[model samples]
Target: MTRVAVVGLGMMGLTHLNVYRSLSNVTIAAICDADADRLSGETTATGNVEGTADASVKSLPAEVRRCSDLNEVIGAADVDVVDICLPTHLHVRFGKQVLLAGQHLIVEKPLARNSTDADELAQAARSAKGLAFVGQCMRFWPGWAWLKDAVNDGRYGKVLAATFRRVVDHPKGAFYENGDLCGGALLDLHIHDTDFVHYLFGMPKSVNSFGYSKNTNEPDHVVTRYLYDHVPLVVAEGGWAMSDGFPFSMSYNLNFENATVDFDINREQSLRICEVGKPIEYPEVDAKMGYDLQLAYFIDCIEKQRKPETVTLENAADTIRIVEAEAESIKTGSAVSLG
Candidate 1:
């Protein structure tokens, strides 16, 4: 069995813990949280861009060690995998420690606050004895995963044009309010679509972006157009400027030579494929969500002594670069080129 230690008890961290518990060959050996109350099983309902938090607030098993110190969890003899679900800025620090300790690491998305920090973590992972992965879970998400398969297998011919969007009400919390910490909505919220775009089509040649900020200078609302030679129109918009009453939504429309695929979280049947002379068809995806699949895949890789092909440190770093470029474009009012 793969023994896992989840560091953090926030919404994402709790979600990870619950998902790991459901997997057959995995065990939640330890849980660490800076908040003593959370470690003791006190939790307040917190909502994220993913929607209402359904994670149980119950206490952990008696066999599972609860730690308030990160070092304690890291040094424990039974912990094999250290999953870092801390804030964006702390990722590199704790990620490097996990790698150097000879423990397999899985860090939540945005890998690091910036490309420079991401590079540092990548270097550590390269030299570490254990494998490293970033939790860019959208890649494993069922709808997006199906799109990737269709593209790779040429099931949709070639992508002609595509637009992706993610919008949600502004998150009211200390971590999110501080742009320097979370990189605001652009990095925290939008990076999902940005990374998915990079996964679908390689890095764009250039990006032209426009943004608007409310309380902070960081871009809470951004629309970016990616320039690619083959694909004529490729764009993605992400923002958190919606009012508190606005429901979170994520949708995508991809037009291919032979067909078009659409996915909207608001729809009852979220995924559909349309083709000429054929009725619209809804695609059935696995009941397990991205969090479950990502953890399961990482555990399997650890047990098999293989590398994760989907969300590697290298690609995660590249996604940071892309986001940085978008920020630059938003500042300069000109398209930024990517190497």
Candidate 2:
């Protein structure tokens, strides 16, 4: 079995814990959280965008050790993988520690706050004996995964234009409210589409963005246009400025030479392909959420002693670079160029 240690018990961390509990080949060797109440099973279940929350009472299994310190979890010899689900800033610190300890590591998205920190972690992964990856889960999400395959394989001919959007009401907490820690909506919400764009279309030549910052300097609402030579139009908008009652939604429409792919999470049938002179069709997808598949794939990679292809540190760093460029464009009111 692939022994795993998860180092947080917040929404994302709890989501990871529940998924790991369900996988057959993976064992939850240990769980660590600074919140003493949470460690003592006094917290209520938190919901996630993916709808994977467990509303039942929270409790640790008999075999799983509860740890209050990160060092103790990292030093545990039985942990084959250290999944860092902490806040954005702590990723680099704990990520480096996990790698230097010769344990495989998986960190949540944005890799780091900026490309510089991300680059440091990437370099550490290169020199360390263990494998490392960022949890850019959209790459493995079923409908999104299908879209990626279609783009790579040229199933519907080259893409002509693509537009992506993610909008949600502001989260209720200090961690999400602080623009410094969570990077506001740009890093926290829009990075998903930014990373997905990079995964599907590679880095853009330039980025032009317009942002609306209500309470903080960070862009709570922003629209970015990615310039590409072949594809005439590629744009993404992400924000958390919607009213409190506004439901979270993510949708994408890709126009191709021969067909178009459309996906809206809030729709009845979320995924559909419309082709010239053909009926719209909904494709079958694996029922498992991206979180489940990603962790399962990581465990398989550990067992096989191989590197992950989908969410590598290099790709994640590039995504971070794109996001940073977007932020710059919003600040200076000019397009930023990328390598």
Global lDDT scores for all candidate models: 0.88, 0.87
Off by over 4 Å in 2: 55-57
Question: What TM-score does model 1 achieve against the real structure?
Answer: 0.97
How high is the lDDT of residue 306 in model 2? 89
Which residue pairs collide in model 2, if any?
A: none
Model 2 lDDT per residue over 1-339, tens place: 888998877777878888888889988898888888877678744654756656222566677888899998895898988999898999999999999999989998879988899999999999888889888989988899999989989989999999999998887778888889889899988999999998888899999999987645588998999998988899999999888868888999999999998999878788999998899998776677788888888888888988898789999999999999999999999999996
Error of 2 at 154 (Å): 1.2
Q: Give the alpha carbon lDDT tens digit for every residue of 115-204 in model 1.
A: 999999999998899999998989998899998888889877888999999998887778888888888788998999999999999999
TM-score (all chains, Cα) for each model: 0.97, 0.96
lDDT at position 37, candidate 1: 79
Please report how far candidate 2 places residue 228 from its true position, in Å: 0.8
